[model samples]
Every structure is written in C-alpha cells, then in structure tokens.
Target: MTEQRFSRRRLIAVSGAALAVPAVARAQDVPAAAPLHRRNTMSFVPQNWQDHFDGLGIAAIVADTTSRALHFWSGDGETYKVYPTSVPRTDELTKRGYTEIVRKRVGPDWTPTPNMLKEDPTLEYMPPGPGNPLGTHAMYLSWPAYLIHGTHDTRKIGRQSSSGCIGLYNHMVEELFAMAPVGTQVRII
Candidate 1:
C-alpha cells in the first residue's frame, strides 16, 4: 500500500462536515408549518389598560379568566405588569364585572364562604399561616368572599383551582399588594 499522510486539521474538518450533513438534512426534512398540540400553560398576551379601564385611577387591575392572567397598571400609567393567575374553578363560582379593592391584609385569615361550606362542610376557619389558602397577602374585592390573593400551593397558579377568588403566586401577590392600593379599580373578564 502507498504511504498516505492525513493532517489532523483536514481530518477534523472532514469529520465535522460528515456529522453536520445529517443535521442539515434532518432540518430540511421538517415541515415549515407543522401542527403543534396545545398546552395548558401560562401564555400572556399584552393588554392595554385603556381598553379595559377609563383611567388608571389609584391603579387598575384586570383579571382575565379566559387567559388566566392578571394585568396591572399604575395610577400615573407609568408602570404595567402582567401576572399569570389561577381563576375560579367554574363559571358558577366566577363573578365577572367591575369591583374595587375594598380592603387589603397581610397574612389574611380564611373563613370559608357559606356557599363553600355547603359544598364541603370540612372547610373550617383557617387562621393566617402555612395552611391558609390566602397565602401571604390578600386584596379583598368589593364583592363578598371574592379576593385577589396569593396561594400557598404553587401548583394552583395558572390553573382553575380557586373556589371563587383569583389566585396568584405568593411572591407575585406580595408585589401586587404593594402596588395596588385600596379603591384600585378592578375588572374581572
């Protein structure tokens, strides 16, 4: 056999090209518009406060049930925030329309609503603690038993898991709690 010399650089180049050929071919084989299965995950579409509120009076919050998101705008209209949230479990439990933040509490206690007790008698009054459903902070709406609060269970966020309240992650609620003052206009759609 004739003596053959192969440089390391040439060998590396050849090997790299060989490896890349399959990847390039595979990429081309994929269809440009392949259908993808839908997922149950948090995906926020940017919302304009003007569309939902007349003005950002003391701040404005819109809890969108279909998108499972909460949008906030500061009173001066300088700051805007979007947070993934857990909506009411069902339409029957959902209270849509306008309301305002009537009260705010840090470490809020949980008293099961009369309707809630009727549904599940086991739900007792839970004091503010680890077990409390209304996580670290709560902003009570004008509507009774309806609140936008944090949840201890992280899994509840971005799902239909609340009895009637809008649920946010504990840290997110704490942030929102600080931003939205009492009398902040709220719209649940």
Candidate 2:
C-alpha cells in the first residue's frame, strides 16, 4: 500500500512537469516587444495582386481582405513574412486603396476616432499596456484614421474585428514594425 501511494504521487508530479514543457516552449516562441529583426520567409503566391506588384523593386505590404492575411514583400519581391490579421468589420470601413506608413509608435495610446466615439460614447483614450487596444506597436497609415497595429486580443487575428485598421498578433506586429519603415507602400485588396 505504501509503495502504491508513493508511485501515484511520483506519477502525478511527472505528469504535471510534462504538461508544463509545451507551455514553456510556446511562451518562448512569442517575441517580446523589442527591436527584433528576424525575417519570416514563408511564401504564398499572390492570387489577385501579383500582376500589380510584379517586378516592383520596393518594399511593400499587400493585404488580402478576403483571406484576412497580410503579406510583407521585401525589395526583392519575395515575401518576407505572412501574418494573419483582422481587417475592417463593416462595409463602410472596408475599401481597397493605396497608402503609406505615415507614422510609427511603440506602445501607443489609442484615442477613439470620431466614428468610434459615435458608436460607443463611453469609449475613451487607452494608455499603452496589455489592456490597450493598440498593443505593443502601431504604424499609422496616410489614409486618415486607418492603421496597422498590434492587438491585445490575439484571437481577433484572422477575423474581421476592427473598425478599419489592420490588426496583427502582438508578436507579429513587433516583428513587422522592425522591418517596415515609415513610407513603406501598403496596398489593400
């Protein structure tokens, strides 16, 4: 009876430790909001916008609204990275156009736009932190109030959840912010 009790306790402890390993590994895979310059070389052939950007020698971003995916292309025309993103939620906010990065901010505070405030009057300014809607970093677009920003709610990625801005996972946005400088061309389709 003593030997069986000891074995059961040992097994429970071992099982708990085993369950912890994958959690630790997953945590390590997420990049912190630091200046990390790692390149993501995942490739996908552009379905709709390839002809528009083929042979273009400038670093650019292309967002596919249908797939809710963002593709970053290097100067060489190869996809540097691909990340799941959240796009505009409503038809009025969803439109395709050309834009450029107007500004970049690290841990940016979010002020609700006029439209947002109209929709939710109680919404107010959000200071930078985990609770902030604009998580970690943001790259504002020249297109008025639109932006490519990180989100605290990572589950929103790969869905249409934002008013108009593009939302990436916090870790992915950190990597993208490091790669995309201001004035980088962005084309949404």
lDDT minimum window of 10 residues, candidate 2: 40-49
Instruction: Write candidate 2's Cα lDDT for 1-189 as tens digits.
Output: 354456888999999999999999977987787435444322333543354465434568888777788888776655567888888897789868788788999999989999899999999998999899999999999988889999999778877789998999999999999888887888888
TM-scores of the candidates in the order shown? 0.81, 0.72
* Candidate 1 per-residue lDDT over residues 1-189, each given as its tens digit: 998889999899999999999999977877868535346477666788889887888999999988899999999988889999999999999999999999999999999988988999999999999999999999999998999999999998889999989999999999999999999999999
Note the Cα lDDT for every prediction shown. 0.93, 0.82
Off by over 4 Å in 2: 1-50, 54-57
Number of the top TM-score candidate: 1
Error of 2 at 64 (Å): 0.9
In candidate 1, which residue pairs get closer than 3 Å at backbone N, Cα or C atoms, i.e. clash?
Answer: none
The collision pairs in model 2 are none
